[model samples]
Target: MPTQNQSLLDALNACVAACEHCATACLQEDDVKMMVGCIRLDRDCADICALTARFVARDSAHAQHLLKECAEICKACGDECEKHGAHMQHCQECAVACRRCEEACRAGLAA
Candidate 1:
């Protein structure tokens, strides 16, 4: 793949790691009950990101459709993470990664 596509793939991978880490860390927090929504979104976001990476890497016909969906999930996940960012380092990092991935996905779709 080209460097441009490679960068998007890298962003997807980073976001996946961030989401997984955030979900795990949230589970360890004292108020696990309050983190339920965040946990669900984190896992969903990670899965979508991984799928998006695969679609893009293979230049699949569904890539554009998946990118759009991925961007939406990333936005939602970032919003959720930002809500807990003040109290959790993992959330803060995940929020940043989600935003980056969101932007990258949109750019890829536009291109």
Candidate 2:
């Protein structure tokens, strides 16, 4: 596979792990209610990222469409995670991963 595609796949995998971890951590937080949105977005992002990665890995014709959608979800997740980044290490980490994944997905689509 092309380097761009490989990088995007890696980013998606990283984001999947980050979002999964972040969501679980958020549920354990003292203020779980406040983190509900973040948690929801995290789970959604993780699922999409995983599916996008698979589409890219298989060199599917739908990869580009999935990448575009993944980028949008990543950005949304990043925005939500950023709101709690300062207070939560997991959110901070997740936000960074989401941004990286978003960029990678965009780059893959452009390629």
Candidate 3:
């Protein structure tokens, strides 16, 4: 089996961690209900990143497809997170992480 590149793995892992953290933070907000959309997207993005990372890490036949979806999801998650970046540091951090991971995922696909 082909080995996964460390850079891509690191980025994907970061995305997963950031997404998870963002979701938890959203849940803790004073108007938690208002953050429902953010939390939902965060959870969804986390699952996508986690699954995509696993697929890429294994260098499976579907890695390319997974990576593509990962990039798209990361972009979406990043955009959504950015909306609340000014009010929430966690959102800002997650946006940064997601953007990085998105770039890495695209690079991994090209590689």
Error of 2 at 43 (Å): 0.5
- How many pairs of residues collide in model 1? 0
For each candidate in turn, give its C-alpha RMSD to the true structure in angstroms. Answer: 0.5, 0.6, 1.8
Which residue pairs of candidate 2 clash?
none
Error of 1 at 56 (Å): 0.6
Give lDDT: candidate 1, residue 86: 96
> What are the per-residue Cα lDDT tens digits for candidate 1 across 1-111?
899899999999999999999999999999999999999999999999999999999999999999999999999999999999998999999999999999999999999
Best by TM-score: 1
Which digits, one per residue and each the tens of the lDDT, describe model 2 over residues 1-111?
A: 888778888999999999999999999999999999999999999999999999999999999999999999999999999999998999999999999999999888788
lDDT (tens digit, per residue) of candidate 3 on 34-101: 88888888888889888987887776899899889889989999999999999999999999999999
Models ranked on TM-score: 1, 2, 3
**All candidates: TM-score:** 0.99, 0.98, 0.93
Off by over 4 Å in 3: 1-4
